[model samples]
Target: MNENVVVSADWLAERLDEVTVVDVRESWEYDGIGHVPGAVNVPFDSFRDEEGESESAERSGSDPRDAGTLPGAETWADLMGEAGVSADDTVVAYDDTHGVFAARFLVTAEAYGHTDLHLLDGDYSSWMREHETSGDAPDPDPTTYEVRDPEHSPFVGREEVEAAIDDPDSVLVDTRDDWEFEEGHLPGAVNLDWRELVDDETRGLKPRDELESILDAHDITPDKRVVLYCNTARRISHTYVVLSSLGYENVAFYEGSLTDWESVGGPIETES
Candidate 1:
C-alpha cells in the first residue's frame, strides 16, 4: 500500500519545487482565498463536465452536475494538458472538500494511466490552519498529455452496478452521509459514510486496523468485489483511496450513483 502518497503540509512545502501542487477547487474558490504558492488551478469540475459543453451529454439531456457524468478521455486529456500537467510530473492535488475532489483528480488521472500522483493531506484549509500561511495562484502552462484509453479503466456503469446487486461476490457501498443514505440509496447498497474512515481534525485517514474493523463489521472484506458510490461521485473518491490503500484490488467506482439510480426508477431502501 503506497499510503505514503498522502503528504503533510510541511512535507509538500519542503518539496514545493519537486512536485506540482495542483489546486482542485473551483475558480471562484481558488480566487476567493488564494492557493499554494505557484500552484496551478485545475478545477475538479473539468473531470465531470467539459466546461459546460458536453456534446454527448447534451444530446441525452444529462446534466453534468449529475454524479455519474464524466467526460471522455480525450476531453480529460485536453483539460489536463491545459492545466500544464506533463505526464512525468508528480501531481499533488488539493481542494477545500476534505481532499475528496483532490482524490477525484487522482483517480481520474489513474484512468489515463498517470500514476505518480499525491494528495496534500489536509488541503488548503489544513495548510492555512497548520502552517499559518497562504500562497497565490499561477497561470497554468499548456502541456500535452499522452492519455491511455479510458475504456480499459475500472469505472462502473449503472447497469453493471444494478447487476452487481445480485452477484454473490460483489458488495455495493453507499459512501454518502447517513442522512442521505436514510433518504434513499440503491437497493442492497449498504450505508458506509465516507467520513467515518477519516479524521476530522487532521483530514487524514484513520488507522488501518480501525478501518479494517469498521469495514469488516459491515462484511466489506478486501476480497469482495466492492462497488462504491456517493451523491455526485466526488466524495466517493475518498473511500476509493481508503479501500485502495487498504489493498482492495477489485474496487470500482460507480459514477452514476444515487441520482442516476433514482432517475431510472431503481429500487431504493429508506430508513423512514
Candidate 2:
C-alpha cells in the first residue's frame, strides 16, 4: 500500500493531536462502541445522495437503479463543514467494517479536491486491541469548506465502462466474491475479491510485496487504466482505495456498478 495514504495505528497515536480523526462508522457504533479520542463522527452513508439518485439523474428524469451515487459538490462541502473538516486539514478516517466505508470517504474527499487524505491501516477493532478508546464526542469548531473542480474524476459512468469493454488499455475489475462473479459479471471483466487485499488477522492491508504479487498475477499492473465495480459499488470502494494506495494513477470506479448496468440491459457473462 502507499505509505503516504495508509498510516499505522502507532503512527496515528503519535500525531493524534495534529490531524483530524474521522469515525465514519454508524453513529451507534461511534457512540456506544467508542471511538478514537477526539475523533468526529461522520457516518459513512452520509456521503451518498439521500434521494438515492445523483444530481445528473434528477436532470434527465432517469429512474436509474439506486446504486448510491454521490451527492453534489455543494452537499459534500456542507457535510465536510458540518463535520468540522476544513479544506486544509490532514484527515485520517477509520471504520469498523474493514476500510470500505473509510475508503469511500477518502475517495469522495479526493474527488472534491481534498489533497491531504489518509486511511487508518486497519479496522477499529484492530485499533481497540492496541490503543485506548473513548465515548466522548468532540464538538469541533466548524470551518467553511468550499467546493472546487475535481483534480481528477474518481468515478466513471456506463458509457465509459462500455467503451472500456473493448479498450485494450483499460482493465475492468469485479471486486466481488467468486460465487458472485461466477453467477454473472460484466463482459471482459476479471474477478479480484476485495477481501484478498486485506490481512484476515490484522484486518489491515496485506504487505506491499504480497499485494503487488497478487495484482501482478491478475495482470492488474500499474500501467493500465483500472476500473472497478461490485453489486452496488460499496464493496469495490475498498479495492479502489487499494489501487490508489498502490500508486495506480489511473484508477476509477463505476458508481452504479452491475445494478445500473443490468437496468440498462448491458451485457453480462456467467460461468457455464
Candidate 3:
C-alpha cells in the first residue's frame, strides 16, 4: 500500500494540528462516543442522494436507480464547504466501520479534485486504544470550497461497466460477501470480500505482502484495469482505496453499482 494514503495513528498524532481529521460516523456517534480531537463530523450519507430525489432524476425524470446516486459536483463542494474543508487541505478520514465509510469519503473527495487524502490506518476503536479522545465538538469555520475539474475520474458509469464485461484487459471485482456474490453478481466478476483486505483485529488494511498475495490470488493485478462495485458502492469503496494505495493506476468504481445494474435489467450470473 502507498504510505501516503494510509497514515499510522502515531503519524496522525504528530500532525494532528496540521491536517483536517474527519469522522465519517453518524452525528450521534460523533457526539456520544467521542472522536479524535479537532475532528469534524461528515457522515458518509452526505455523499449520497435520497431515494427518488436525485439531481439526475430532476433532469432526466425519476428513475429508481437514481436513488442513492452520487450528487452533482456542486453538491460535493457544498458538503466540503459546510464541513469547513478546503480543496487544498490535507484530509484524514476515519470511521468505526473498518475505514469503509472513511474510504468512501476519500473517494468522493478525490472525485471532486481534492489531492491530499488519507485514511486513518485503523478504526476509531483502535485509535481509542492508543490515543486520546474528545467529546467536545469543534466549531469549524466554514470555507468556500470551489469545485474544479477532477484530475482523475475515480467513478465509472453503468455504460463503462457494461463494456468492461467483454474487455479482456479489464476486470470487474465484486467486493461483497460470499453469500451476496453467490446469490448473483455481474457476469465474469470475481468475488473478493472487502473484509478480506482488512486486518480483523486492527480493522486496518492487512500487511503489504498479505494484501499483495490476496490480490494476486484473485488475479487482480496492477497491469489490468480494475472496476469495483458492491450493492450501492459503499463496500467497494474500501477495495478501491486499497487498490489505489497499492499503486493500481487504472482503478475506478461503479458508483451506481448493483443497485443500478439490477434496476436496468443488466445481466447477472449466479453461482450454482
Badly placed stretches (over 4 Å) of model 1 are 1-3, 50-67, 130-134, 150-152
Instruction: Write candidate 2's Cα lDDT for 79-123 as tens digits.
Output: 989989998889999998779889888877776778888889987
Instruction: Estimate, for each residue in 1-272, the C-alpha lDDT of model 1 and write its tens digit.
Output: 14567778888888888888788888887778777877888887667754322232223233222224566667877888887888778888898877888988887777667777787776687778756444456777689888754333557667688789999899889888788889888878888988888778877777779989999987799889999988667778888877877778888786666656666677888853
Which lDDT tens digits does candidate 3 get at residues 1-272?
A: 23479888988999999999999999999999999999999987877665623232233233222334555677788888888999899899999999998987887777667888999888798779899999999988989997765666766677788899999999899999999999999999999999999998888899999999999999899999899989877788889888878888898677778877777678999972
Q: By TM-score, how accurate is candidate 3?
A: 0.91
Give lDDT for model 3. 0.82
Model 1 CA lDDT for position 234: 74
Which regions of candidate 3 deviate over 4 angstroms? 1-3, 52-68
Worst 10 residues of 1 by lDDT: 56-65
Error of 1 at 187 (Å): 2.1
- The TM-score values for the models, in the order shown, are 0.83, 0.91, 0.91
RMSD of 2: 3.0
Count of clashing residue pairs in every prediction: 1, 0, 0
Please give the lDDT score at residue 269 for candidate 3.
Answer: 97
